[model samples]
Target: MLAQPDARAAAALLALTAAFAAVVALLPWPAGRITLGAAVGAVAGASLLVDLGYPGPYRLPAFWLPFEWLALLGLLFRAVRGLSDRRVGPVGGLLGLAAVLLPLRFSLRTPQGGAAWSVVGVLLSLLPLLGVAGAALYLRVLDARRERAVARARREQRLEVARGLHDFVAHEITGIVLEAQAGQLPDQEPGETAALLRRLEEAGLRALDSMDEMVGALREPGGEGGRDGRSDPPDREERADGATTRRLGLADLPELVTRFGATGAGGTAGVPRATAELAPETAGRLSAEAEATAYAVVLEALTNIRRHAPQATEVTVRVAPGTDGTVELTVTDDGGPSRRPLLRRRPGAGGTGLAGLTARAAAHGGSLTAGPGTPAGWRVSCSLPGR
Candidate 1:
């Protein structure tokens, strides 16, 4: 059965049409009028049946379709009179008119005679049918236009959310990294440098966690509500109060590596050799955006290794503070050659994985590069502004 229209306006229109059909069926009429009225009522009922949320018989006699014609005319009248605000136009109108008048002509005359009244009926019917058909076609065009508008609006909203995430998270992470770098200078006290690095890691990890939640909301079903609430003073205050203090940063990278290694411990990949080299100060200062970017980059790369380079026995992750104070993350695997390498892999294999990584990196004013490494393995690397 056809799915019922979900829009309130469409449902209301169907209900109104069904009511009109019932009235027409009950009205007094001559014998021929009674027959036509019954037919029209049947057609109306059938149309409304589509809205009852059940599958029914898929076919009806062609002769019975005259009732459908009448229903269409009713729809056209409703459309023109603005009684039904639905945009169904000339195509529906024409079909509806044809359904009514053509059968009337066919019934009035025998095959051979083709009487004058029959001809007149046929011709008169054509006029309304043509008008209604044109209107239906117009309405269809309008529907297409409306659909495009809605889609564009949704796209714009997503981009806006992406932009906000980049600005807030990237900026914060960059600051953290800068402070860590300053502490690394020879003149800075060792204790102070260590403390700064720890704080930076904490802040970056918190941002990363928050970003994951935000991204989840963006991908939420039906796109109801996923926006940056940071503009609200209360929300900002709460953020300042360190809701992210429990976040995981570079300091946690070793744990992440160990966890993955444990998962593969008994498998053919054999303990999944792994390493992490994130500078302590740099790790502490990472921004949320940078951290999130780094996390995603590592996650996707490692996932690709497991899925596509399952034979790889060792994986190495190298994260460092860049000369420009950005965070550079690289995931390299010493597995058998990639079945479908990142750079020149089979079409569909490379598209979704690499494209998502690229978009994530670009969103944070960074870049991601993935390809076959020099020593016959795969490598995924990303560089993002530090916190």
Candidate 2:
């Protein structure tokens, strides 16, 4: 209901008056004591007229009966409007129903007691009330749908920001961790340690840049930008180094593998060297969404290797055409000793990185799997649909 004091108090007063009148009307008073019944009916009629702003004479003769019912219906309409927007209890609903039916009391005042006229009159009044209530109910339903749509849009935006942070910052941080560990090796030369420090600086800068781009995406009125107002194509975003770059895909894997190999923990010869064997013409065969998801699969697998099996001697990243016009990508590491627990979960089976990539692949009509590879290794692989 409205917050206006008058609206609140009047609705409450009218409801109470309706309940009192109903009790009095139901009582079997002596026929000679007609004044008591008149008093109760007068109270109900006056309250309805005042609350509904009738502003006419409060006469109860047969002539002004129609106006009285009109005022009562106006009260019903207002009640329906208020109740439709609120959480009413069962008692509230029953009281509201009883209040509107008070118009039937008008029949007892007519000469010869026109009970049939009262039934017809009240039934006719209810038809319009039913329509108004239905309309109010429909409007309430539309409001609920609009609220749900807003909630859904907000949820998707949050997920997009979360995925971007996970993909970009995690990759750079993994590189930094590996570089730090490599610099700490006992056999490290001063020159090699200085080079690792430079790489660490670059990785830290890249992570900061990733965060800035994410904030910019949020502040930009619409979405990730292009020269015009239109959105940039998928998986492409502005980088710290420049205005725009293909953040991931077939074209980027060679550089990604190079960086992973360069960050070899404990030094170049001590840790696994990463290699890429990407098929020619595969980029032209895949859609942007599928290609980006493929790139994410490779990035996550490589990062997992750095975290789980830093001592693995051989790391291989391969992408090729699969059966029936599909592109397949795989990353495998020889199950070497790990700095962490030996009983680690397979990267593809369950990890935040791989779990997100699995959803992305499935969205692009593909699937991912991770488990033991041939001849003693852990492998993460996925396939995506191609043109």
Candidate 3:
């Protein structure tokens, strides 16, 4: 469908052409000036004729000259006006009028009472040309607008895919990194950390899995998914796997906290104490994209706490179930660093992490905000649509 702006622009161009033609036709030139005026007008009108597919009326007999001049002039104005407005209808109609008027003009011009007939003929011929031009312009405008809208939509889809890749895969990979550093994997030999390395490799593979999915979607014919402008049905097996994967929602926050504790064991400062408050199925109900985004937000927050807030003894992960069927996940760390630095450090420190999180949230009709917490430390929170 043609958008409102394109439709209005096309209509305005057509209306202007019609009005200009009407005014020009109503003017009266003296008999002595008629031939010169018609000649000048024809030359000026001919300038616009190239845009038409055929030559305009200047070929009619002497008796029909006056009316032919009017019609040709009107058609020329309509064609030129349409071009100025980026429309095509007027040009097409002008072309048609040229074909009719050129022959009639060559045959009709005479010294007698042909002036009145010329005016009537010109008006009548130009009217149909104007109509044709208006229709062509409208269709062309609609087509151009539709192409632009499709391009914009495709760009948005790519950004969403990038966000999803960064959020889901990055977090899962970070989790594996932390776990490996903490020596949580089963030890196979006396001195070999082969088992831990294997677990880390497994985590890397999982990250790869998410990345592959995103890449597949991006490379798919339509950008997001599918070719030929159609979406495939959700695979039942994939949905089942996704449901199982989403089970690691807020309820698993404690385990994540413990894992952080293990990573921070060597230092004098302890790992931050964190908590989660969320509904049982809130994570599952969220679209795959939204869940991926939420996971990334939480993951980035934890990563920041581990990297920058080493002195912080308590970090809280709170997932509040909002009344409006949304979940607010906040990760607050009690560490020293004013609000300004927290804000400034985000772009420089987090790099693609924060940006990716923001894109992911936006894709799912959500928002992510990060800044300093109330009393002390930093806070990262995301308001995500729930299932």
TM-score (all chains, Cα) for each model:
0.39, 0.70, 0.55
lDDT of 2 by residue, 1-387 (tens): 223435345345445545544444444443475543243345445544443442222223234344444444443333343333433233234334444554554443332445676577567766665765567557656767988998998898798788777787877876786677666658667688778788899889989977887776566353335656566666676543335666567888998898777766433347577899988957678877677778878888887777677677789999998898998899998867553522235456435778888888898889999988788768998989896
lDDT of 3 at 274: 58
Error of 2 at 231 (Å): 5.1
Candidate 3 wrong stretches, greater than 4 Å = 1-104, 107-118, 172-192, 221-292, 310-315, 323-326, 334-368, 373-376, 384-387
lDDT of 1 by residue, 1-387 (tens): 334423444434435544555454444433564443344435444553432332222121123334545655654443343312342344234325434444332333233323465556667777776676567557766777887998998897676465435433543444354444444446556576566667577658756875765564455343222234333331121223223223334556677666445443122333467777776657555665457557656655665665566556788898877767787888898765334422224454333555666887787888999888867788888888764
- Where is model 2 more than 4 Å wrong at Cα? 1-92, 95-102, 108-117, 223-247, 266-271, 337-350
Question: Against the unseen true structure, what C-alpha lDDT does each candidate score?
Answer: 0.54, 0.65, 0.54
RMSD of 3: 13.5
lDDT of 1: 0.54
Which candidate gets the maximum TM-score versus the true structure?
A: 2
